[model samples]
Target: MNMNMDWYRIFWHTAKLGNLTRAAQELHITQPSVSYAIKQLEAQLEVKLFDRLSKGVKLTSEGMEVFKYVEKSFTTLQSGEDRLQKLKELSAGELRIGASGPIIKHFVLPLLDTYHAEYPEVRIRLSQGKTSDIRERLKTGQIDVGIVHFPFADHELTVQHLANIQDCFVVGHAYQHLSQKPLTAHELSNLPLLLLSEGSSTRKYVDQWFSSQGIQADADMELSSMDMLIELAGRGYGAAFVTQSFVKQELAEGKLFQLHTKEPISPRAVGFAARRDSTLSIAATRFTELLQ
Candidate 1:
């Protein structure tokens, strides 16, 4: 019927208080205004909603029936508003995130720890995958934010640079002598090279770096996991290309040694991305702010 909601609001308070004056006081309106609204409502519904009494007013049988649904609808609306406030405050909500395993562990974990500590009521959903996979999830609305290797280019996403990452070749005791001096790209390529498997952003960057130096990076061992590559490289399998920050412990402990190249490897970056068209949930926004 497209009736005015103000009429029903006045009716609810009036029915509850059983006094038009009190309803008007609660609504911050004149008693005559309350009476006029009630009259309009009754006329629209084509029913007597209240019985005028000397003391106050009483709901008619028809008014009681209509009140039931009105009460439920208003209650539901109030509940929705309360939940939205909680979400806005970051006291309750879900944060859906996606990233590669290594980035999640080395880059995103500390930020998550801070976020969780502050907003313990927020539900965190973390999905581990390649950068490409993370982007796909963002596109499909499966994830609210994505942590990926940059410079990531996607017209559909708004990306913010989080941190810089340096990729270098690491080796074990078997190749200890090679780390003594900066080797040429040809010399480095000729050594038994270990690398992350194809289809990863890191792998693509490494391949491009080698190509730019006029060398072909032929991996003696290709693996899907950076940890596996590090493990294999540490066991003296071959020199592995990996993020420098991720192998700090091993480097400090002399388990894995960083190799120097005659040509410096270009440093890349890590960034978080979200769909440009969608608004991030409060929890996600706060988490990203913490990361920043």
Candidate 2:
């Protein structure tokens, strides 16, 4: 189309006010300039945009259709401009974050709390799911950054290791009567165990460790939430496999005891992931800095 944005704006104003003189005054241009712009636009589109009415002007069928789109475009442009202005003024901007439930609860929440305390005007939007799920969101631009466990497979993303995590089997005070000596993999296989759902990183790591020792675990229950697993273990449901840091408070308070393992589980890296080429929001960058 030969019509430029300037002509579209002129046509939009004229259609709204239904008078060339009024539109020109609103636009701070001469009436002929408004008329010429509309005429040019109509000629380019090969459609009559306005019908000369006795009192003023009325949109023809084609004019109404064009005006409908122009109206929506201008509204959207105005909204974008307003948002940009707000961002420039530091009055508003959204921070989208992706994380698993455990990480969000144990790590992201505290950092976000501190961030919100400092920047109360910034809006935070959090999405929680499995590490793989969060990774997908990060890749697709659905979230600005992700808090994920280590060993993520995506090569296109940049990762920053924030903390080292150790996995441990925790049991309640009811099991305190057991000896404090380290339990062999073969011995642990015979005890009732609570674990995360199959295919989870935690579950995979546990399974690998057990397999290497030629032991078959007696998994009595599968739970989705680490908090629930801790609660159940505290109630003597079974020995639950969880991150040591996650249950540090329970361990310290004597509500739970860590079962001695013949071989301590290797520590895994927990960290932030972001698209290699995407620009991060100020809030997200600041939060990442705190994690680092």
Candidate 3:
């Protein structure tokens, strides 16, 4: 037999209130309309659902039995709706992120902490690598989004500018007594420098700047990890070329000092990158919104 959900809704409401007049008032219908719905449901079910009393009404045993099932069904339906609403509100889902070391430590990590506090059920997956590797993952659909340094060459990716990161030379406390006055790019060439590995974007920018000024200096050392560079610089190994944001705490704590250069290294554009053709997951979109 065909059954309407509205009929069940009416029946559920009447069962809860146990009075036709009260059920009608609660459902914003007239008493006759409420009675007619009950009659129709009873006719379809072939059962007596209610026993009329002087002041109110009560459910028959059969009505109570049917209602137990209805109550469970409707409860489950409400629960399903609540879960969907939470997903819409960004309380669930997963966000996959790709970022270089400095960006992850200095920026993305703090933002992720905030995101987690607000959306505990949303899972965040972070992959750390060089800027080039991160960009490659974004293109290949391995990562939903990336934090990269610019002059990126990808024409098919969308870039959203977040901040400008200033590059500087950091040194150990032993160099603290050195002149704070800015030195020309030529003078900077004289300092032994602990630099990031050759292919890194930071290294590329430094190389280009030196080339522009007609001064190519020999590196004191080359390291693959930013943490290693920072540690070596703190140990008075040599000056390390790094972003200002990455060493702010070290500079403040006197573990590292910034070496001023006359031709200030141009700031790199730091931002979010996503493939042009891909749709972002719900969690990724929410996190991106938070970044902005």
Q: All models: lDDT?
A: 0.92, 0.87, 0.87
Q: Highest lDDT, which number?
A: 1
By lDDT rank, best first, the candidates go 1, 3, 2
Location of the lowest summed lDDT over 10 successive residues in candidate 3: 173-182
- What's the ranking of the predictions by TM-score, best on top? 1, 2, 3
Q: What are the per-residue Cα lDDT tens digits for candidate 1 across 1-292?
A: 9879899899999999999999999999999999999999999999999999999999999999999988888899899999999999888999999999789888889889888998999999999999999999999999999999986999999999888889999999999999999988899889898998898998999899889988887989888889999999999998999999999999999999999988999899888999999988888888888888
Residue-wise lDDT of candidate 3 within 1-292, one digit each (tens)? Answer: 9988878887898899888898889989899988898899999999999899998788999999999999999999999999878778887778899998878988899999999999989878899888889889998898998998888768778989998889888889777665478888787778888888888888999999989999987788998778888999899888888888888898888889888888868888988999999888888998899888
lDDT of model 2 at residue 162? 86
State which candidate has the highest TM-score: 1
Residue pairs with backbone overlap in model 1: none
How well does candidate 1 score on lDDT at residue 213?
87
Per the 3 Å backbone cut-off, how many clashing residue pairs does candidate 3 have? 0
TM-score of each: 0.95, 0.72, 0.70
Q: Write the per-residue lDDT of candidate 2 for residues 46-132, one digit (tens) a residue.
A: 999999888779999999999999999999999999988877654788788988778889888998998788778889999988788
Error of 3 at 82 (Å): 7.8
Candidate 1: residue 87 lDDT (0-100) = 94
